[model samples]
Target chain A: MADEKPHCKVVLATNIAKSLLEEVQDGLAKIGRKPLLVGFLSSTDPAARVYAEWTGKTANENGFAFELREIDREELEDALLDANNDAAVDGIIVYYPIFGNRQDQYLQQIVSIDKDVEGLSHRYIFNMYQNIRFLDHANTKKSILPCTPLAVIKILEYLRIYNTILPYGNRLHGRTVTVINRSEVVGRPLAALLANDGACVYSVDINDVQQFTRGEGLRKRRHEVHEKPGWTLENCLPISDVVISGVPGDKYKVPANLLRDGAVCINFSSDRNFSPDVKEKASIYVPAIGKVTIVVLLRNLLRIVQNKIDAAAEASRENVSEAVQTSES
Target chain B: MADEKPHCKVVLATNIAKSLLEEVQDGLAKIGRKPLLVGFLSSTDPAARVYAEWTGKTANENGFAFELREIDREELEDALLDANNDAAVDGIIVYYPIFGNRQDQYLQQIVSIDKDVEGLSHRYIFNMYQNIRFLDHANTKKSILPCTPLAVIKILEYLRIYNTILPYGNRLHGRTVTVINRSEVVGRPLAALLANDGACVYSVDINDVQQFTRGEGLRKRRHEVHEKPGWTLENCLPISDVVISGVPGDKYKVPANLLRDGAVCINFSSDRNFSPDVKEKASIYVPAIGKVTIVVLLRNLLRIVQNKIDAAAEASRENVSEAVQTSES
Candidate 1:
């Protein structure tokens, strides 16, 4: 019986991100210019430094330019404003926890929407939560979703989790997903993204567990939320088709026994959120999603560049029309 | 037994709104000037015209100057721009469903943040969804909440549904609320607001049901979402301590039998969403919240006026310091 026990596949993010990175490289080559991503690092946290280095390396290898600006916490506001004004800087990312409070939130708004590669700015965040897909009335420019959440989405797609035969927005219909972190940047937004795509998303954290779903109706774009009191991992885990964890602590591990058999498990946190034996329960287990996140970040950068180009072209067209009208008049 | 079913207390929104209206009136008097609110009406909908009339009457009664600008749908863009540039206009309201599509959404963005009395502007909506309370770094200016949602919150507070004993921001800590409607302008934002204040909100619409809850930790302000697959009104109603409904169709009724005994019921729809016998199961019932909603709108106008004053003062203070520095140098 022991010899007959099935060994599940362990998937790597690097393998998943390979084709996406190439696609991003192709996108950049077509754009005909290396979009410069300026990253502001004001934190002394070693993890922040390492993440910035990883981003720089990823950007360089993928037909893009990455510049890390190490500045004092006090100078971050000025640096962000400068970057916002600089046409050369196509994207901006700030290493968070600089002030580590509401002040940090204020800092997020300083990066203009046009250059917000991480999609942390209010405009993008608003469009995302509202499930508004495009930036303009004409729907020419696609809205950018936050990198980590978007990466998880891409991973789910690559895994054939999203039913391609279903309508575009309802691809995750009948799917049940449990996201174990509700952090504003990753977990909450990721849940919203999934729910908007027609999944029953259980968003879990230390405080409580909440469920997210898109309301019925073809017109409903944004997801709605409901709270489930006294619900624990014990209740949700066994029912979840996919369990995604991003709890950032070394001591924490998801109990394999609670997970549904053959469930797909994913971890986005820097720390491992599952035991080595998680594969015994999970049909496909992803230990990390960092590489995929970098790819998504670059994809967002290309999107910003494309949006700019589209806007400029629109402006030129408007100007030509104006000139023709003036001459006719 | 039918007679012994018990008569629940009925609360009128007019009585509830009285004190708030007085407070707003006093606020306006203190400001020493009537804040002009310009409303743009392009729709032929009689409901829109009646609402415009109500707004004008309410504004006049509460020391606000209300002007209704009836224009063709084609001219609404120019009208909004004029109102935005006209500093005399302290707040702006546009009767929606003018185009009744994404174009209506485009029109919503035309209302400037500083003067958006409806709080439909992306900035405010984003902040509201994110649970961001203040608009600026200094925390001096309070972010505006959409009037209808804010009205529901106020009614909840008036009914003591919010546990005032708990610390602020966690007032609804143990409450289970079911809101039957996920309309963008009301139900969705209302659910987010309730969950942010610590209620377990079951946001129900025609299509599906969802759960909304704020995560644990004192620092977490925004509410998270989760989807409840196969959940219906029957599943949510009996568990809900409070049932708030805004379904517009007269045919749509929340079956009384499904409601929890002693549940608080409130309706904000033009059409009542509960049956006459709802009072039997309800400990408290509010048939309509339109009066309270108008009061909240005026309150929002006053707030916008106050924000402008504060901004002007800050500007002068900065100028004074700049002048002092110039002299010292």
Candidate 2:
């Protein structure tokens, strides 16, 4: 299997191994493309008493072999920089905790963009801009779309939303969505992406909700720059058709009690210790944000990874091609 | 003044005349800085026409001065590339048309970051992400804020919307804003930015809108990926207290007839002409779509542009500095 070309491989990067990651890896593996669980483990996942047993359980349950590996934090960035097609990695899955100081920069510093599992890197975002304006398809194989954003599309799918809901009044034309906690990696980046998908975007800082957008023109009272440059928690919340929140450990912020009644909330805010209260309030909470729609993002991620090896390989191949071309010329 | 010894000189590229360009140049011309306009139209500006022609009359009386030159269309991109401060041009303006083909990529390409007039390049946007997560200043000059976003900030100066509005009982935020187009020139990127600034962002595309985010949880939607995607324009409209629109041209299908009465509409749509009905309805149409704010935009634009040049210069200077240090050592 390692020698053969992969349809796609999922490189799951996380703080620890979990049943969801195993289920996904096994599910894909059964279908031929397995997922690599790159996470913090008590031991080698396959050797760990629990996972080794779970691996057998999950693999048999899904009809394929599940693989797991532990990655050193110090080596992660270096490994990312040096990754290539022959490098034994295909896609990437990042399951990280929100509390660490280095977590944010580390995630931002080296997204597995070259071999990105999801198109969450700067390059992919740039590619998205290009695709929208220039209609050019780039990094389709190597670009990784953020899973949360893809999940939003999935939510629309759950409701059976489609193009027919146009000319203004139906599904969500002229819609505006304000994302709280813009820095919550998945939520903020995903918001911009959702807007690009065709929704109007109202992004507010989770902390300083009104720093960028002051509520004027509309009926809301927003502060002036001269008076105060920040927004309080009160200035942050507003009526919305739906909410996609990933700010965890703050159940009070997204509990059933906090949401506008009837407003659907999709919780991507799950951690290892899933909260019953949070889940109860959430319209839906899942281990994977959205699966099928991730195809586009996955393809983009593969392309970037492939290109790294392709560039070097292509460079050497250029000599042979040049010889052939020289004769023709 | 053009010939005077300069601390530094950066090029200003815009869609306007060289004279108005010069006024900007003169205002910013201090001991170590100079702004050179890429193109100059002789007959228009007051500073250029009279140089001191009194009364400030007739609105068209003033002619602008300063260094100016115009380049042809095909050569425009090339001029920008040449102006990329390889030690020749300091910075570039690369102005957008009052109304023309989307100039986002064109703008990004010319921005060159630190040398970016206002650090409005793709590089800078990602840099902002790093800053958001790390709380580190971008370390470039102050010339990087996009003009439109800045204007919005300036608008907040007088209004103080955040201060006036009270958040809801559920910690429900006040107003939400939804901007439709994500043209790099203005739209999705801005939305993403606003997300970082902190607003709940619910981005939607035409199809996503058809799938209104009405019912269900995040996971329930995640599980429904097989369902079709649809969208309605109204679905994308902000349900919050405020709505800001920056879509350019007539193709923007935001049905004005559907706008909820009392919703403040700030239109950035310009086609050199407005329908009689639109003229009747708009509460405020910022003439030239924040063109007056261009000067402020220029402040960032020039800063980024100079930063790029300075960065390059510094890199080279470091080599020299290294050599000197080596010699001393």
Candidate 3:
């Protein structure tokens, strides 16, 4: 619904430093709002990319000005956390390697859910799955919906995917979406969100598919294992209309045998060399690596701030008036 | 700050019907703002309490109008859920259950955090904890908080039991507080909130605590147990400092020798009168059956609403405008 308007600012936090982010922050600053930036090391940036959209994009544009910062290892645990809270920064962005102690401690210290522009806080992500509306945290939510997920609904609507059912124009209502990968950023939280959205969703880490089991429950449950041949074609081909692959490899080998007829395929990889036979058979393709996430992040952040802005303002006004009355007395 | 001078409309929702909260709801209505009561119920009028608040005492005196209705479970869920996307409601409220489901699926069925009134949405609650800034569904944010928890806080604050800490603001900061149950309405969420508020919170369930090792890591961990004690404290008499017990009956006993010096004990079951010695030695005694929760519930709800009232009004206006656009289009 938020479309075609002039955007105020956009930032991209990388696994570099605040100083480094500042070097490139000008691109966002040019958008007429003060840009906030943060950079980690290259190893940390990929994981950080998932949440970058909100921090990079969703912020208060009115009188909105921000600065960039770069942080390191020891900083990830105790010290950097203090900076995150103490900086009184409007928003924070982090780009770090997808793994390691740095990532874990950094996550612990990254910031509060309210100020987490990257939306990396586990609490933030979990609540998104819960589907409650989140007000103060920009781009994060009661349900862990990123712009990509919401966009999926919009795209479904645009395409008018006839087989799907929409609940009052909500996209995720009745469709079945099976996501491959169980990383913190995508698989689990997204699946939770889709389930909350009323879709029958199946999330499996491709790496664990070898142990797939058809449990007594309605849907087949499976353990994830990478490199199991039958796992790809046998597990997903028959069930899902949409297959979202969030693995990093540029070219994933899926025999046409595994591509369900007219299934929509979303690739969250940067590899352009993906085989054509796959795309030729699939209904659609979306590369989530950089293209879709930026927009989604911005939209999500906007939703968060927009949700609560007025109430905070009013409360402040009330407090002011109360103070004034007491002063008069 | 949202004293009785202002007027506002509100909605209420819960697992139980709104009727259960009539007295308190009615009192809430009598406060500063003109009130509107909206509710969701499976059978009874849980929402009526909210109605009683808005149209109750103060609102009734102010001659402000209010409406109350019990919506269908499915319909209400659809309206509140982003997945279903029913976008008509303005604000949503939910009552506190002393003990109930902790999974949050039911809570997720409420409106998106956007229109959610009490800030009970999981993501919204986590978000609120981070910033400590209250937010309204659409516009303003003030001190709107969860009613029951706020009530608990009100009592604690009013009583001045917790003292100040140097940097973090109060003694609650980094203090190990353990909640023994997994109540979405109270136990689990509240512990998380306190931790987010800078307390060192240990949200211990029976499963976790029962499995806990006594040395090293947990040697100093806070222990909060809710299950009826299998073994009597008659054997283990190392008394702790703070005991907030929600267990029922006097079957379990706290022998005079079991309590540490200056330990503040909160007992939910007050009928089984404590020995005068036990009462006299204790620094604090909390009668948990009702007293604090009732008044706190009302004031907390009021704070949540008032803090963000101005912003909410703006959001309401915006919603109206959007509705107009929808009509025109």
Q: By DockQ, is 2 or 3 better?
A: 2
What is candidate 2's lDDT per residue for B94-167, written digit by digit as tens? Answer: 44341254553554555455445444676665644332322126734432556565555434222222221112
lDDT of 3 at B66: 29
* TM-score of candidate 1 on Cα atoms, chains taken together: 0.51
User: DockQ, per-model, please?
Assistant: 0.01, 0.02, 0.01
Q: TM-scores of the models, in the given order? A: 0.51, 0.36, 0.37
Instruction: State, as a TM-score between 0 and 1, how close model 2 is to the true structure.
Output: 0.36
* Candidate 3: regions farther than 4 A off: A1-68, A76-79, A86-88, A102-109, A135-165, A168-170, A207-232, A272-274, A287-289, A300-308, A320-329, B1-329
Given the true complex, what DockQ would model 1 score? 0.01
Candidate 3 positional error at B317, Å: 54
- Candidate 2 chain A, poorest ten consecutive residues by summed lDDT: A1-10
> For candidate 1, lDDT tens digit of each residue in B129-242?
988899998988999999999999998887766644345666665467899999998999999999888777899988999999753222245678999999998889876768
User: Residue by residue across B68-114, what tens digits does model 3's lDDT show?
Assistant: 44455445555346322533333444433312344335654455554
Better of 2 and 3 by TM-score: 3
DockQ of 2: 0.02
After best superposition, candidate 3 residue B151: deviation in angstroms? 58
Error of 3 at B237 (Å): 67
Per-candidate iRMS values, in order, are: 20.6, 21.6, 29.5
